[model samples]
Target: MTPQRRVTLADIAAACGLSKATVSMVLRDNPQVHPNTRARVRAELDRQGYVYHRGAASLRRAGAVNAVALVVNDLANPFFAEFAAGVDAALAEAGHVLLLGSTGESVERQHAVLASLVEHDPAALILSPAEHSSAARLRRVLGARLPVLLFNRRLDGDGPGDWDYLALDNRAGARLATEHLLARGHRAIAFFGGHRDSSSCSERREGYRDALAAAGITPDPAWLIECAPTRQEAARQTPALFVRDPAPTAAVCYNDAVALGLMAGLAACGRRAGADFAVVGFDDIAESAFATPALTTIATEPRARGLQAARLVLARLRGELPASPHTTIAPVALQVRASTAAAPDSPLQSSVQARGPAA
Candidate 1:
């Protein structure tokens, strides 16, 4: 027995009693086609098990790709998850498909993912790059034609490529959180979570240092604690904050996850957040509001940033963006809650007055 031939636009057209172009227009979902005609063609196409190969169709057209590619460092993180959701929502509204990939913060995996995505011929790419992603490496993998929007992290090293940048105001956000703690009379404050080498972490650290400097308080070198940005790592590294004499009364966490984790760690260490210790986190992820004692956080509006990222890449594809490398630094806001408070014995101090010994 011979295999059946694949369905084509001509076959659908003949079956629908319409011209091939009309069937093609219906397949493309072009509004120019009459609704009645489009409905009839769609019905016949579905009945015949027709598959419209988007890649092939895009190839037939001039300067077109069927999908927008989004590569995020870690989808498990709530902030990035929300950001990716916003990207998908905006792309869907614009009638484009989203091709998604994850890197898990591994640069080697990022190279592989980008190389594979390149084969699909995406119109543009939005990447929340993995740790230590380099400009030269990305340029070699992506070639010069692909329009890219770098989210959150900058590429490693100088002479940054011409990719567009959408970044959170890391420094200002950290400063805001630190200042909030300072206003509550906490003198020794720690900047916790994330490796210092990461650009976002470095910027936030600078902000924390800046806030301390402005208050005529220099941050202790020991007070700047480093860990993986994840909750587990932050929790595991909590003991480091108390190793020095006159431990921090407050902490500016890298993000909400780290803050929530530190809160749990504080409890295990017999310290109560919002009481003996104050905590402030960045990236106001949804869980921050509901965490035990509720977290004080900086709101970076991750989902909205994701939407902005999609818009930026789409603009690049449409030739609406400048030829020069452009950066959009999103603003942040401080959200105060139960997790942060004044020093234990200070005037206008936190409601719970018990302090962990030796801190």
Candidate 2:
């Protein structure tokens, strides 16, 4: 028979002629163990090639996001994919890994995901909340213990005291889109998609109204559609708006996804996006630039937001800074594309010849 393995914790204990418990205590760096005993155990451990497990060290060091749980509203959206990639890169640099979960825009789903994440005992959590998440529900799952950072979206009517938030300047981005439409001589413009209670949607709506009011135009409430944040829902809603009497000459969409869906819907109605109707979208997603006619959009840096979130988590974990309860990232700028050009000065005119193609 092959010789038994020579070096185990038992072997070390035998060589030192000490009890297994004494050896364990020494190896574990228990202060109760005498210094001489610890020195002897260290010498034996070195001689025997003994290695201690790191699991205890990890648990001791965990603050929030030592192992991070990244919760998002939708995984299908490319915006979330790119943002998660950025979060991964940042987390890797900090020696932490991200665990991602999607809520599918359901409050019950959000609750389930949140509950599952809590059970895993992550060091920290980052959430891009769904529309109907409640503070009471979140607190019940976490029990006021683990640190959580809300990203991209906020809890409705939430005060600053309960949580930390990192998000984009959605209102300003909306203002940019609306202002761009206004600059291009669009008077009858409409806001599209997104639910009522979402802070992001509400801010965007506020900005839309602000721009309209600034330009001496009253918003037509009938044109504002609080549709679901999905392509199919946006597609379903678009034709109804287009078919209405006194249809809007231009529409400002919630995001690139909504804009793309609206275009699809317009196609079904035998309407061309840029040629027949002007549309402006937000988020400046990669596909938005390559879409047919291209998309005129307000740009916010999602990757930058992800990186900032990672830094926030790591900083809190390392105790390098106090937990910031509120953080807001501003929008970058508007990118004008082929979409959302003026239809014509007069409604009866078929087309207005451009002086030159948009650069």
Please tell me which predicted candidate would have the highest TM-score against the true structure: 1
lDDT of each: 0.87, 0.79
Task: Residues 68-168, candidate 1: write the lDDT tens digits.
Answer: 99999888989999999999989999888899999999999999999999888888899989989888989899998888899998888836557799999
lDDT at position 198, candidate 1: 85
C-alpha TM-score for every candidate: 0.91, 0.82
Best candidate (score: lDDT): 1
What's the CA RMSD of model 1 in angstroms? Answer: 4.0
After best superposition, candidate 2 residue 337: deviation in angstroms? 1.1
**Tens digits of per-residue lDDT for model 2, 235-299:** 88897676567889889998888898998888889888877888888888889989887888888
